[model samples]
Target: MEGMNGRSVRGVEGYTRWSLISLAVGEPVLLWLLLHTLHDGGSALAGPGVAVLAVLVLAHTAACIHAMIAALRRVDPDRGRRGLLPLAATTAAVLVAVVVVLPLDGPAEPVLASIPRASAVAVIGLATIGALSARWPMRILAALTVVVLALVTLTQLGSRIGGIIYLLPAYALVLVSMIASFRLTVWLLEVVRELEVSRESHASLAVAEERLRIARDIHDVVGRGLSVVAVKSELAATLASRGDERAEREMREVRQVAQDSLEQVRTLVSGYRATDLGTELAGARAVLDATGIRVTVTGSADGASPAAQDALGAVVREAVTNVVRHARATWCTLELGAPGGRGAPGVEDGEWCLVVANDGSRGDGAGPGTGVDAVVPGNGLRGLAERLTPLGGTLTTTRSDGVFTLTASVPSRETA
Candidate 1:
């Protein structure tokens, strides 16, 4: 589930709180068990032994409580070893108490009464440490605990083989359950850590992808604008050298191209610019006309939706930019049409198609074009294709008979 700030909330973050709750509830249960043990088992010991047993029980309880607190702080591996010290103290106290109060000559009732005490020994030592320690160490500690308990139980039961067999299984079962609980809680914490790392990785990937898209957009904007500026400035210089009267007008047009390119670059950097079909057509005509190319545009742009317009406009801009930069031909044609009409045969119905074709794309009758090969798409065409893919459109390029053609088609609906 998402948190208030829109980040995903981790269920595992509640682990420490739940652990405290379990410890709180388990605290009362442990107290009740201790009281019952003292009330019932007190009869088996004298006044001095009873006092010692109480002190031992209290020490063991305190040690277990301390270990549990340390376990919470033991998330760092460096602190885990420090946490184990308290659990070791708890184990020592439990073992000492068990040795002192063990009744070999007592009746079966006193012997049976000692079972709770033995179980407490396991719970206090094994449960706290098992939960905090890494898996391998936890297993080693668990094995040592089981072994010590088996020896203690065997000593108390004496020569009764059947009693030893029955009581050992009960002791093993209790210790195993406590250890398993600890392991499961630790595993849950590991899963939560992994999920947090995965979330961070996904965020980083998203940022990198966005950076790539912006770089592509900037390259398309600046590269096309600069291409036009270069062509117009060169044309102005050529006319000036020939002492023509129109050289001053061509220089003025070059200055205008430079000014427009600057404004477009500023809009692109600020991310407020949107490509429009009308604007692209006007820009294309001006750029091609300045370069002395006959630019003929034949299409009804009003029939296309806003999304189709943007996609087709981007195609037009990029294609026209390529014509100025790479294609050396004297004539360029741009056509727009609804699907399945005589103007756009082989197009699907209810779709809009844009066509940009130029004969100047052929170069030296050897490469794809005369001066530059327009058949091989630059960054502009690739970026245009990328933008169109998500809008259910396709950009296709083909070259034949020294002519390079760029076609872009999209669904007729407006995109939000």
Candidate 2:
């Protein structure tokens, strides 16, 4: 346990120092270490052999100290910590080199203090770079290690082959391991990023789908109930002048319908849906009539496909919604027709078409529907378009002075 604890602490300290060194000066120390390992000890670990090892180790130790200082400054560039790291690293490196290079002082045994110290420092530097950089750079370092070994094995006239024999293979092995580890890390990062993007896209699509669902529900519930209420109220008003008991009953029915409408509206707003074509048409007419606007709905087939009906339904709803909100007109018309030879502009569709038009708003400046704002289809129009697309259909809306129009066209299954 004690041994493990000691190793853990050493590893941590080594990592911290190593990071500092690389930040201070890119790869100089590592380079020097490689150089010395290649050139040092010409089969004799004494004299010049010792000197070479001593210089390499000492230089690395210095680099490590310098790196620590640089890292600290990088983390916090201002204040008193500025020059301290550089100074400390330089002092440490020099002192360490001297201790390692020189033999033990006095009449005892030969001791180079920096041997252990240099090893510790180099380890720290190596670890820090590995920790800080992504895997690609590490792998490159690893693969190039082969080249470095090849360089070592080559003789330069006076250079001896003894040192390269052992150290070259060791360095090559370390390089291979490091490169593989880094490559794995890089692969992992890419995977994580892709996952994150996919998750975000899914979340966005879900939100959009939810909003579409809510809008459809609202159109079904509130739209239908409101239509019924309008019809009953109109019937009651007409009967009021005739002195009929049925008129009073119609008024009560209107009130009941209004209440039902409110409840349905609330339910739809809360994400409930129960849709029917009749209700939607009725709702559209009622809404238009409430504004004293004439409303007309015409379609040839109740036998229309599910897709066609939905497309038609969306057009009517959007037309009503716009006329009620923006057109401010006293008259609106809905026209549905079968697929014909003449294709509608803006829609590449080749099928039946749904057209809803209202007397244009009389407002000064411009009509309620034109330009970019014309495409300013309320959520209903946009949703209709999407729903129609699955049915291989299209919806087109247009507005002229005091006239608002919506067209929903579905390509027949053959064209689709």
Backbone clashes for every candidate come to: 7, 16
Question: Could you give candidate 1's per-residue lDDT for residues 305-399 as a string of tens digits?
Answer: 77777788888878888887777767889888776554454467777888888887554435434433335667898899898888888787766
How high is the CA lDDT of each candidate model?
Answer: 0.64, 0.53
Give the CA lDDT, 0 to 100, for residue 354 in model 1.
84
Q: Model 2: how far is 277 from its true place, Å? A: 33
Once fitted onto the true fold, the runs of candidate 2 whose alpha carbons sit more than 4 angstroms away are 1-160, 189-208, 225-257, 266-416
lDDT per residue for candidate 2 within 1-416, as digits (tens), equals 11122223344445544433444354445434533443342221246645665555455445444433443331333432344454445445544543354332111111111132222333333433343233224455455444444433432113333434444556456655754654454454345444545555755886899899878877887788888888888888888888878998998888888887887667655433334555678877765654456778776545566556555666666667777676646567766666554444654444776677666555342644443225466677788788777777766665554455666778655333
Task: Supply the global lDDT for candidate 1.
Answer: 0.64
Models 1 onward score TM values of: 0.48, 0.31
Q: Considering summed lDDT, which 10 consecutive residues are worst modelled in model 2?
A: 105-114
Query: Which whole-number lDDT from 0 to 100 does residue 220 have in model 2?
Result: 81
